[model samples]
Target: MDQVVTQKPHELLAETLSTKMAAVNTLIQTRMASEHAPRIPEVTAHLVNAGGKRLRPMLTLAAAKLCGYAGEDDVKLAATVEFIHTATLLHDDVVDESGQRRGRPTANLLWDNKSSVLVGDYLFSRSFQLMVETGSLQVLDILANASATIAEGEVLQMTAASDLKTDESIYLQVVRGKTAALFSAATQVGGVIAEASDTQVQALYDYGDALGIAFQIADDLLDYQGDAKTTGKNVGDDFRERKLTLPVIKAVAQATDEERAFWTRTIEKGRQEDGDLEQALALMAKYQTLEATRADALVWAAKAKDALNVLPETAIRTMLVDLADYVVARLH
Candidate 1:
């Protein structure tokens, strides 16, 4: 994918991150086999072996190393993070009834929903086992709370579906619970495992939370503005599904009486027709919700950088700051 900021990844940071990610990759390859059933292995490997950016695991590794950790548990934690992310992807595809992901057929689309869901469960259990191997109750608590938050976020989004009245406060909470919780926990636990000072620990947690928030907001905004080839999914998929995202919520608040009536009839009532796509695009542009959401993303990204002040300025910390900017810079 084309990164939108900082002239692609810096060479030094890319090499440093790459070395850490290699260890994570090895751990995943060695541990992600199925013991109970071979079919589980087949299904798990389909997505696990598929090329992903490995951002989550890299976050874990980067946080650990930046906090001066050089132990084997970090490897286990890195693998745990990747497993959790992959399991979420499986469950997400099932929930969204998605056909494509990362330019490939989704597991639920390639196989049946049964394979996707059950294999997702298997991965979840395996991730738990891997986390337990770390032997840190705090790590377990952090990830466990994150998993619950993620589920709550999904339920909130489902309940809020097609509701035109969903406000910015509710939207932020949903994005935080669904996306930022895991990112924060992954990085926070890395600091916890490294036994960083409380101040350092809080800084890492805040940094991850802000980074995740910015990233999700950017993702939602780019759904309308980005190239389909770059984003690896259909634009207007959120609109077609009648999901009320940040851009739509902001646009609704800014709509005129006639525009509000149109939204109520189409978006709220789920009465999309053949030309709904063009109509939604025009409405979004008319309200400038895209620009508003992007501003929110940049705000959180700046907060992410601010949180990094407690830590000494290392290359990794600088890289993390740059990466945070990259997430919000997508809209530009």
Candidate 2:
């Protein structure tokens, strides 16, 4: 007998789009270089080279190719998408006071918060420059609005994450702003640059939005039950950090008076003690919130797949559908 292996959907997409991805990578490198500041590239390269999936840029490429685009603008948009994403990560690590990213020490830890923030600003400038080169006002507008939405989402989370009053609706709004906005923008701009039909572009945006929501929901759920080694995050890191994710929000909704008190102390008041993580897991299990969260993720994944009905049947499209499934498949 012979052992068999299968490449993940993302891996398959990367293989199919290797040439364009290479161009995106080259453009990213060329644009990240600074004449006066040597530290900018050093900091930017740290996170960009970290073992990220580069899924957002790939989404841009796939959407453009699926729409029959045959120009270099897709590559530019892909690089632009990546720069925006990288810049967000740099800023997020600073905002969260995070010490690690992608299983490695974060740039803020490697250098300083000032360096990370300045480099992130540099990347945002670079991303805008790349988008401007494409000469499409629609593309520029979409990305610019997404950049603002991302900032607003972060601020919302800053206020909402520790509040017991946060609900599912607020959580979804934050998700849309922080995660889905960029995903949808990345896909939508690809179609815009390719001059895709309005219907087709909307479909791409819907797919990316649903996929991003499912991706974030799944990530939040994993923080409660996921394997530390596999997830690169210790179980209940969100709980420990006092962040009110979906599972916790759902659990809080169904909590008893005593449970609510516990939540207030641990989450709202940030007075965690030993075994608090276990207690949080116990509450989630008691309410079956993790299962409910998983169900929600599956629904979004289905919506993502359904959004592709308007898209042409292509290999890239198939990979995208599978990619949506793969985003929630980790829950199993």
Model 2 lDDT per residue over 1-332, tens place: 12112778999999999999999999999999999999999999999899799999999999999999999999999999999999999999999999987789999999999999999999999999999999999999999999999999999999999999999999999999999999999999988888999999999999999999999999998888889888889888898889999999999999999999999999999999999988888898898999999999999999999999998999899999999999999999
Clashing pairs in 1: none
In terms of TM-score, the best-performing candidate is: 2
> Least accurate stretch of 10 residues (summed lDDT) in model 1?
1-10
lDDT for position 204 in model 1: 90
For the record, the alpha-carbon RMSD of candidate 1 to the native fold, in angstroms, is: 2.6
Model 1, position 226, has a per-residue lDDT of: 84
Q: Model 1: how far is 259 from its true place, Å?
A: 1.8
Model 1 spans > 4 angstroms off: 1-7, 10-14
So what's the TM-score on candidate 2? Answer: 0.98
lDDT agreement of model 2 with the native: 0.94
lDDT of 1 by residue, 14-60 (tens): 46767667777777776767666777777778888777767777778
Task: Give one clash count per candidate, in the order shown.
Answer: 0, 0
